[model samples]
Target chain A: MRFDLIDHAMAVTGAIIRVLVYSILTLPAILVVMSSFTNGETMSFPPTGFSLRWYRAAFENDLFMTALWTSTYLAVLVAIIALAIGFSAAFAINRFSFRGKAFLQGLAFSPLIVPAVVLGIGLLQLFAWLDLTQTIYPLLLGHLVLAIPYVVRTILASLTLHDQQLEQAAMNLRATPLRVIRRITLPLILPGLLSAAIFAFVTSFGNVTVSAFLTYGGRVTLPVQIFAYLDTSSDPLVAAVSSLMIVVTMVVILAIERLIGTERLA
Target chain B: MLAPMIILLTGFLVVPVLGLLRSSFLSGNHLLEGSGFSLEQYFHFFSDSYYTSVLVETFFDGLVVSLICVVIGFPTGYSLARLPPLARRWRMIIVIMPLTLSLVVVVFGWLIILGRNGLLNSLFVSLGIFASPKILLFSRPAVLIVLVQQFLPFMILSVMSVVTQIDPVLEQAAANLRANRFATFRKVIIPLAVPGILVGFNLVFVLSVSAFITPRLIGGSRVAMLGSLIYERIMAELNWPSGAAMAFVLFVSGLGFTAALNALAASRFIVRGRRHAL
Candidate 1:
């Protein structure tokens, strides 16, 4: 009875410790947003006042607006391009019994593991060799490299979950491959496509290490802007910009959740 | 269709990374400027304690953070697996939220949370836990906290997928055979769960080791890691060769660690399979 009692106490203690650690881990970003309410000169805890002026500053600031648009534009372009490539590759790998299928799959997935900094460096070097330094094309290509793996992974997972019999049935019915894909496979994998696209968007939008290296002053993305802004000034402006970005990100996440119901995403 | 992807992968990823390896070999005082290579950069990396320390730090950070993720993620993973099908849908949202969110946003969130005048300080003040705001940000502990938070979902989902594959009846059988719940968990559940746990460890470790932005923004200059060192060498100093060397070292070390773990996993899997076959 004493041993059982001791075990129960130990388990409870472990649970409490786990809870405290998890809560502490989740608190940092939330607290930063709350700290922005401080009307003081520097960021201070337990703000003397609460107002949304910093949020107002983030919107009104032209640089922030430019960076936001840049990030959004790049994100959208990256999604479209990545979807085109990733989907095609996924289709080819899934449908065909080709040589080097595993190798191709590994290649497709390698970008996810390869450090962003390495990708950034390699692309920077590649583009420089091609004389495309600090260009939008390089940034686009870099973002696509990062985004492709996510799209491929999500699409592959979806493809695996789906029935092969449907495609085989379509083939037996004398349907052309293109027609069958359009009429059968596309609809089945639309959820995956949607999920993949969301991932592509987020990957491109939130990229830093790769985007940071690729971006110049004229075409700085939101993260680069945030990094630069934080470096230059440790003020409420950065807090506001970060908060604004977070809100935008949260809205997109919520929208995706609403659209597909987050199960499809998982 | 795969041709284009294959070509892109070969040209951009495989070749460039290979080129980085070659670049690490070439010396400034070389026989040939373009082609002839020496072991100068590798020697530099190995010989210099400053750069070497960064490698060690990176490895340890990856180790600590991934382990923490496993510890935190296991129960969450179990809870998720046991959830009703309806509630299981929301579990992905919770799981992928951090994964999909921009690293900038995550690091920013950490900055806010761990910053001097951040959330914890205010909470502590209110609760009378601290007399004043404390400096928690930029510390090594803060990096682990932020990283574990960021990677926990990955670890959880990885384990949960495997856990769900397990038959609950095995647990019931164990119980029926006079085992307590804890004994059932230990004997029946844990062995089945090891593969998932190892996978989660590999994924999180790979991520944490190569991570630059997180360690940079949250950790400050005090917490030097290989990724950040490479960044400084390349971006700050424009020392591409040295930066490439550091990146190559990090890449090699990461590859080695994953390979070792995977070999360990494969052998263990075979052993388990043999036992089951028996």
Candidate 2:
């Protein structure tokens, strides 16, 4: 009887703690959505009234839209470049046994440890000194550097899970290395590649620390623009922009959940 | 295969970082001049009491926030680990949603949630707890709250991954030995979960100390962590050397903390392994 009572108490404790913490973590995004619809001049919680004024404000604002476009294209370009390079590196490390393989692996993953602030400043100076800051190449390259490690890691994970004999069997049948890769290796890791694309896209799109210094001329990424905007205004339009991002993230996360189990993501 | 990655990472990431290091030690205010070396920048940085205080405060803030994450996240992660796959999937979404949001957007969401006239104040007003919206933004508590919201995902995910790897049969054995739920949790679960807790703790701590955006956006002018201070040096003062020094200090401190933590976690792991072997 006492044991059952103790179990009941623990259960009750777990239920209450779980509910409280999850709400605190999740409800703030809901509040952002609600407040973005406010009719008032300034933001208020529970919102004063419902209107899409801020949505209109966000749409009408040129800075937000341009930055959004810049960020989108930058992310797309980064996904392509990082995917191409990262895939080859991952394939090499996974399939081949060679000297310096561990060193190569460590080098590929080293950026995960370096502070983004450091990377931002380093790239900023590198570009400015080389007179490359005037173009978007710095931004492209910086995001590429940041995004590739993730791509390599994800593709390697898929490679690790795949059985080796299928590729060997294809090779034994007198298939060329390129043919084996095109027919067997590429088809097997498509899901991993897709996830890597998503990973690269999101990292590049959302990056600020690196882009903060590398944003050349009038071209700013959305995150950098939003951070600057928040410094000057406390208006609900920022909330509207944020809400849209929240919605997009929700959708991407859901799509990923469907394609690959959430277990593979973290 | 390795040629592309090697060339890209070396030419960009590695070379630039070397440039940054060289820039920090330059005699003049030149960016990465290969001509000369000096320590005046480091001297100027550590000589000032204000800069020293910022470094200290950044460490303190990281320690406190990291502790809170472990406390809150361990329990929460364990709960998620206990859930069935279907239930866990939905819960994982709720957890990862905040993580997936852009840093700026995440900070913006919290800007209102903890704003003066925002959610907390609104709740208080409706419940007659406060007469009107109170000032909560740009304060220490506000900064702490936002930092937690931003990085708690790291903690929860780390702990979850480790916790899930532990065998459920061990807990079953504990229960069968007449240990109650609380006793089993204390003896079997906590020991096994230590690795996750340490992993989560290191990630949250390392990321917390190096994070610049959360401090800049939410903490604002009132709070001066190393990240924001480094930003001021580079952006506002245009003093590259000083900023580089501060960034290194931040990076080194993170390295030291993690190294110490690894030693602690590894020692425990070795002892545990030996016991199992015996």
Candidate 3:
């Protein structure tokens, strides 16, 4: 009887701890979402009289709109480029065993270990030395480096679980290698590819560290713009912009969840 | 097939880093100055008391935050592993939701919560814990709090992955052998969980040490970390060589620390035929 009672107490303690930790994890995003709806000019908690004025303000601000446009197109280009490289690389790494394969794999994943700030500064120097700092190429290239690892990781997971027998069966039917890949392998890994694209998109879109170094003239990414704005001012427009980002992130996350299931993602 | 990735990585990632490394030895403000190589930048870093203290504090902060993540993450992970599949799936989404959001947005949330007359202060004051709202932002503790929040998901996921693989049958066998719950946990579960804990520790340490946004915003100008310091030197001061030296130092220390932990973990645990745990 005493043992059962102790077990019950322990279970309760564990449950409480889990709840607390989850709350702490979600609290920040929740607060940002809540305050973004404020009617007042300044941001305040227990927000005063809910309104969408700040969202309007965020949209009306040309600087933020330009940043949003820049971030969108930049992220799209990064996703497409990263997918091309990541898909080919993941396919090769997954299918073949050759000399220097391990070295190649490590090199591909190496960016994850390197600090983003280090990457930013190094790229900044490289671009400046090459006289390419004035163009948008630096941001694209920098974000591609940041996004490729994620794309490769997601696609590799999918490829590992893929059935090679299907590809072999298709090839045995006299299909060419390209046809077999297009008809069998590509179709099979479509979900993984979608998830990988989302990963690349989110990574490039949300990046600030590397983009901070690479943003030239007025072509800043949305997150970097927000960072700069926050450094100078405190207002509800920042909250509105942050909430929109959170919404976009949540939508992408949900889309990924729908495609691959959150279990594989987590 | 692998040509494009290799070429891109070598050109953009590898070459740029090498360029930065080469410039670190040069004595010039601008990167293209072609000045003669010297050890002046590294010497300046070591000779300066401020830079040295910042380096020490960065490592110290990383250790403290990683330790806290392990302490808090272990229990949560254990519970998560024991959860039913349906419950676990929904909860996993919640766990990863914050991770999907931009770090800047997350920091903004913290800014509101920890700001003067913000959620924390207002709540505390309403409860008479203090006569007035205390200044909570732009401090070391605030930086630590945000860092832990930012990186805790990685720790939880790492621990959960390992804990989920530990069979429940072992625990049942221990109980059948007359072991108590705590004894079963200590002897069976903890030994199996060490690899996961080490991985989580290494990850959190590396990430927190390299973190820039949280320390910059929450800690503000009051706190100086290696990430912010490197940014200041390179971006604000235009001291590319000095910044490159600091970046190299940060990279080498992170690599060395991770390698040391892996070696220690491998020698102590994996060599005893538990290699599969990692």
- Top DockQ model: 2
Compared with the true structure, what per-residue lDDT tens digits does model 1 show for residues B1-278? 77667666777777767766666676663221366667788898899888788788889999999988877788777666777878777556556666666677677767666677766787897899999888887778888778888888778877888888898888777767777656656667777888888878888998888887777888888888788878877788877777777788887789899889889877877687568536
Q: Model 2's DockQ?
A: 0.65
Model 1, range A45-107, lDDT digits (tens) per residue?
556687888878778999988999999999999888788888999988887797878988887
lDDT of 2 by residue, B1-278 (tens): 88999999998899988888878886555345556678988888789999888888887888888888987887789888878998999889888877777888878778887788777888898999998778777787778778887788888888888888989998888788788888877777877788788877777777778777888878888878888888777887887887887787788878887888789878987687567536
**Model 3 lDDT, residue A113, Cα:** 85
DockQ of predicted model 3: 0.64
TM-score of each: 0.90, 0.95, 0.96
Give candidate 2 misplaced runs (Cα > 4 Å): A1-10, B27-35, B276-278
Badly placed stretches (over 4 Å) of model 3 are: A1-13, B28-31, B271-278
How many Å off is the CA of A49 in candidate 2? 2.6
Model 1 chain B: worst 10 consecutive residues (lDDT sum): B26-35
Preferred candidate (TM-score higher): 1 or 3: 3
A1-266 per-residue lDDT for model 3 (tens digits): 12655567666877787887899899999999999998887766768888899999899999999999999999899889999999999999998899998888889888878888888988888888788888888898888888878889889999999899999898889999999989999999999999999988999899887888887666899999998888877798999999989989989988998898876764
Q: Mark the 10 consecutive residues where model 1 chain A has the least summed lDDT.
A: A1-10
User: Tens digits of per-residue lDDT for model 3 on B125-159?
Assistant: 99999799899999999999899888888888888
